[model samples]
Target: MGKSQKKRQMRRHNPVRVPDSHLPKGLEAASSSSSRKEAILPILQKMESVDPAERKWACVAVSNLIQNDPSTRRLLQGKNAVGALINRLSDSEEEVVVEAAGSLRNLCIDGGFDICAEMYNKNILTPLKSFIPKISTTLSEYLENPKTAPENAQKLVYEFADNVITILWCLSETSNKAMNAINQISLVPFLMSFLASRERLPISTVTSAAQCLYVLTDENPPAIEEVRSNAPYSACVLSIVQSREGLPQANGKNKEVADNRGLALQVLCCGILRNVSPIPPPSVAATVDVDRDIVMPTLEPVLSLISLVEASQHAQEHIAKEDAIPALEKLSLKHTPKSDHKTPSGLELERLEHKLRTVQLALEILTGVCATLPEPDFDVQDADGEATDADGDEAHEDEDMDDEPEVDMAPDNEAAVKQQSGSNATIFQTLVAPLLTLIQPTPLSFPPLNGPSPHPPTTSALSAIHVSALECLNNIFLSFRGAKIDAPRADPDSGRRIWDSVWQALGAVGTDIDNPGQERRRATWEIGVGVLWGVAEAHVKVLMQLCDAATDEGVKVKCIGTLECLAQHPGSVDANRVCTYFSQRVPEPLLQAVSALIDIYSDETLPYDTNFRQGRFLDALVGSVEGVRKAVRGIDRKKERELRVRGEEVRDNLVAFIEYRRSLGV
Candidate 1:
């Protein structure tokens, strides 16, 4: 054939060129070369075909392509594959519907919050609301007569239920409208049915249901009330948490995998329990059966998850380091390769990520408990009229020279001391210390270039953990009335250790603390002279630094609030002195911090999608700034006047915003 004819023939033999309209904007030029996305265009087109079998096949293909494949999910999403699959949910074919829902479910997992939000915006919930009752009815039929359908058909029904429930659950996480729709459909009881009959259902189906219920009940009053009112549902979730009966049976190597799955389910159940029940007051805690049976049991599994994740990371780091060493070095050390010392597989990494998420959720729940649990009513004063320490009265001779002498536990209050120790032990061991660990960064072993690197816990994930831990500690501090220690020579300390650790954990990001030689005064001071300053002085520096440097609004809010709290409530004589130190040492401390907060509160560029959330955050900033203004009164009278004037301006602006939002009925 002639060259021109051969070129035309080759063009015909070449893959059919996808139209520019099918590709995401700006990718039209690259479409001729057949991008990863264009490769899937035919499948997407087939999803819209008149043939039901082709549509079903296309949907299944999309599901399989996106399953555990985040990169492909993103490509497909950019190509409007999500919209196509969402449209397929309302397709005439049953198999098409199932495959479409399955694809959406995987997108929710692999694509995470952004895709879930996209799906919600595309009105996925409208179809999902319809699917909920249908799936529920299908499952009901299966439960009523399992043998009526062929076994494969029965499995399909379960798959459909699982996929739909999971998509609903994932969507509920992203938007309030989706959550309300889910609640309107009475999804809570349907979810509980799966958990109630977990053994009879596929583990995937049961786990998906449990996870959906977990999300629905968090801060969702209707769903919470539904679970609360149903004794069997409550008992079933609590039992799963306590016994881990939902964990699949496995032997040898598979046991570890089974345990991870079981523990994950347990964490979800614990989260569900946490949502439905409030922490009982200390007076009722000892007597409340629910507290004893459900709430207390939740902590162990959560703590175990934290420990497991940490242990796995350490093992991985060790293996990575050993493998990184030179062969000559290994020979010199007489090292032998460990058969099991392999890099974490994708599945293991996914499990680790899940465990970290569970840790964050668990910490948040504990934070709620800390915030709501009532203060102990016991009197600190003994017969002699001297107050006692709650954290114990052990004296440290090596304590900083500026430290106050430790008080002796009140003599004749042996019973109180015992009770106090028991409670303190539990809180510190289970909650406080773990929060501290999570707040600190996980260390990574340095891997050689061109060598396989260890998959360390991500900074963003660890940062999330840090924020959660900080919030929990904040609650602990607030709930306990700001850490009152009546012991002798206590040195006016408040969150000294916590602030120091947090500062280090943050790596002092967005700060100048890491400048050369600044490490000597990393947190506070040296042993002599200025070291005599109370912990309040040191903590003020850390909080102010963090407040100024933090980008996360939540972190900034916590720091600003904590600074104000410390200024208002001086814990000791040294703390009182250090409270004044904020005025004396830090130049216009409250002024800068409050001004930053006000700026954040009023920034139109960073406006929240909902006025309510904006207003609430602004309200928090207002309270915090006002407290700091009252306590520190700026660097001096002159600076104080400036702060007051600025505050007046902020107040006016805030009032106007509130009125505007109120007028709109938001």
Candidate 2:
């Protein structure tokens, strides 16, 4: 009671001193201010008798005071104030510089713009111009000999750059000379160097640079043109171009390598995507997100990287080819701005569609070129008119280049092993043919998430490629309408024995068989899907093959599992196509079996591969019932009405399934 009474008395006597917004936005900002303007002005004028602590608070008070009231605009007219700020920009006190910048920003408001303009007009730009080169040289020296880089240097660089960018951005429209002066400082070089550093620069710095440039270029073209012509801006552009080629090499870890590669792709995408002048497919285009202010010209160099993949594929450099594909996909992955976290829409979709079309075209080119390679071909090119990896890597066993047909379907018994070795002779015969034919290596990593770290951690590329390939595959599968892809089929001449053999081979590889001499077993799974999406002239037959394999005891269960997972791909065959398959390939017994499975296993863990289809089938069943009402409109009204009632029953059943699963936490 005594402690509570004391606290109540204290609350009655004192309350918060400042209005909420009048308080500085941050810890340092608050600490840098005076308790009052009268107290603040005294500190601003002090040349002596001040502790660093008092000086820090004085800086905050000054910045906050100016921000809170326009009367402080006259501070610029006071030579002492402007000089103090400029000096404090180089202050040993971090708070001092932050506060100085804040105050300066306020001072430069229209009433205060004249004060800064007067300095620039009277040759203040000269000091900034002279000072920047020294700063740049110092920063460069630190980069070259990092030991020489000062403590808090990144902060210094950011402040210095922000000041210059803001000034130029604000003044670019005033006169050509003002713009020219801005260009002479070579701010672009400094900013680019910041960007190129593997070390993460502060977001504040990057943001300031981006905003300043967007304002300068978009609002005042002549200023931007001048800046571009200057050595600094040109150097920045060149650094960006070189960075694409400097993708970090993978270490032994495939996953880590994939991740690092993804980072490279992100940089490239961010760099190139701004130049999205080309168009995209409408539905595909619907997914693009556009918000950042990066302009088209800036995107040009990045787009060139995609062409590099095509060129490398032509040249036969496997590593290069691999790099280019993943890189392109990464760049095309959805990019958004930090200022706003929202998906792309409207015109942005059109822009995305255009970008996607280019990617699609590139995929076609890559697949076609890869498919045309000599049986054991590498996807990269070397400058010296020499080829390597065409015979496959010497580290691995090689097969003769002739005499083979579809995969070996039988188990890898000694005879099956011998058959596989024989088939390997047809090195060009695998499913890589179609994948290499239709899909472009994705350059985008994951969909847009967080931005890069202080340094891009090294293990991102492999994950990027795998995920991108999956997404692209999903999209490609979805794109499969009823149209037949012009792919080669198993020979009808062999009474479909070749067709059966090929599938057997597919099943064989998908099994857990030991093939010590196999070049790649995943090759089997990849090729099957490639044919399904790209060259399936007989969609109904393939559907039957997949269904039979899933149910048949003779086929290994894992093969069925693989097909089940593949079906989840977004681009996997469309739901409409599912109906077509249901009509043609789904037999009455199988439909009944599927329906039975749902009823019996409503709350159980479905068979490994069957889970996906099970859920889909339930939904399909519901749709089928809905179709009853429409079908009975003109004829068979009584049956239509009956089916409509039955449809409601099916829908109700599905609701129960969902509720049941929710209860079990499945």
Candidate 3:
């Protein structure tokens, strides 16, 4: 009795521990602690349970565990959790299928190429595709009794459809292989159908469908062509862009949700347009007539939205500036200014950012179309009055160059149609006008230091609005560079105005300084320099101003670099016009700025290494100074003398700095 009692007590006190060898192959490696593995292994096992209820619960648990946590997701992947999930996608219980799909969707978030490749190899799309018809059927049935259908049922259907499309989106984004696989399944038409029937689908489904299309078509020419080939796709996109049925209200209680939904739809539409109308310079040679017709209608809504956002932002700033109490009045009447008057609401900022993105996408579409259009051809005649080819061949020699059937060098019919549609006018009024307004300086002065700053600045770094605007402006100028147009008499002034805004935006009150916190300033400076460089001939004055007025070393260096680029390579700018402008307008300020830069480099008091800084700033400066020296040699002998003298001084200073550094073994 004593031996039996002792044995029984010992057994009760020490429970048996399972060995790692007995567990699934990779389960032990999923987590560091044995106890954690023990906890998770049961759920993994239960996922394979014969009972559908247990499997459904397991799927939900796994889904939640991996939803937002990357480490847990990686661990699950290591444990072969994907194979289990894929198996459950075909589960007879609808709940299990939905949960498994949700789980897979979460895993695909930022999953990287390897995980996505594995999922693709597992034929994840087959199960995902299978769920579409099932969800569609359920949705159709639910629409019959929309008011009476249970909320859970509606949520389940929407979530399921969202998950399926989201998984497909992630897969398509992973690599070319996955995209091709998706393309083979006719995914574009599938998603386009969902987008077109927005009345029947939930907002979530419609958004996901659009997002899926966006991913599928992005940089995928064949997929884009597929979408372009679909007869109803462009109309569907235009419909979504124009629809106001479910738009966000300004003061609504669910403003954030409504705003997000609107933004999603807009972004999706823009993305489709962007892909279908490829941006230029890596020109898409294969033309799609569908995209040609879509350019203006797609832009109409986007540009209008941008104008509204710009107006609202202006109004908000106006209110913030005007609402302040004067300092003397505050002392006399003992009134305090409202603290909350300056900060914009989160929803307002989100809406503005969304609109900025739409504007960027719209500009991208315009840029693409402009790229597709033929450049204005100019005939070159020899001094002897004989026409020559680009290679300097005589007209008869050009005929011998390519004997293949002479392809029409004339502008395509699409270009003629675009002109007839007055797209250029619409673009100038809609896109260029509003963008110029954004960069234009306001009349309000900065308030006194003791008072709050008038026009409170946005707290965001590198605001999407400013960046997108700058990028769009750059693309417009670049695309139109050298292209002849029959634009109105004011068009040349429009170009000058663009230059004025760019200069003002780049060198505005807060931007000239070198503050790390002022990230937007840097972005503005970079993009502004790019735009000016694009239209260097027209903006020669702006370039001169940048070289003279810029105080930041980086800005100084970049401006010099841009001048060098202009002088060395005029790009699409008329070389004769550039030479004329530089000869007439740029020599004096350009030399002054260069002389100042030499003095700055020669200064010995600064703590930084001159040699190190020189490496960064000298090449561009030398190139620019020398370029100016060469350009004005004959036209302006006096200016040429001044440039040579300043340039020699800079070169001597730079050489002296290098020699001194080397002597010190620095």
Q: Is candidate 1 or candidate 2 better by lDDT?
A: 1
Runs with alpha carbons beyond 4 Å of true place in candidate 2: 1-37, 47-57, 71-80, 83-102, 109-123, 147-157, 173-177, 198-200, 218-666
* Model 3, residue 73: C-alpha shift (Å): 5.2
Q: Write the per-residue lDDT of candidate 2 for residues 1-666, one digit (tens) a residue.
A: 000011111110001111122233443444344333343446565412245555555454444343323223343234356566556656666555555555554444322234456546555464455556765776677667766656677556556556655555555444556766676655555555555553455544554454344334433445444444454443443344334443322221222221222323333333222222122323221133321122122222222323323422322332222221111112211331111111333223222322332333223222222222223113222222233232212233346634666686566566754553443223223323232322222222111122211111101221222222223332232222222221233333332433444454455334432332121234334544454443333333454465665655334233333333333333322221233334222223222323333344453432221332333544445445444334324335375676455444544565565456446533
User: Which model is ahead, 2 or 3, in terms of TM-score?
Assistant: 3
Where does candidate 3 stray beyond 4 Å?
1-84, 107-115, 133-151, 214-426, 433-469, 484-529, 535-537, 541-565, 569-577, 580-666
> How high a TM-score does candidate 1 get?
0.56
For candidate 1, write residues 1-666 as lDDT tens digits: 000111111111001111122123443433432324544777778888998877876776666555333345556777899899899989988878887887777677545567777888898878887876777787788888888789999888888888887787777776666677667788877788889887778877897888788778777889877777766777777677667453323221222443345656676776677677753333232233544465555543454344434645744655444332122222111332221122344345545555565566556556655555444332232223344333222233444766776678777578765554455346644565556566554442111222212432332234345555666655554433333322111222425555565556555322343443222222212111111123344456556667667777567656655654544331222222223223332223444444433333243322121222322433444345445545544336575677467666645555565455445432
RMSD of each: 18.8, 24.3, 18.3
Q: In model 1, which residue pairs have backbone atoms overlapping below 3 Å? A: 404-489, 405-488, 405-489
lDDT (CA) for every model shown?
0.53, 0.37, 0.53
**How big is the positional error of residue 452 in model 3, measured in Å on the Cα after superposition?**
31
Candidate rank order under lDDT: 3, 1, 2
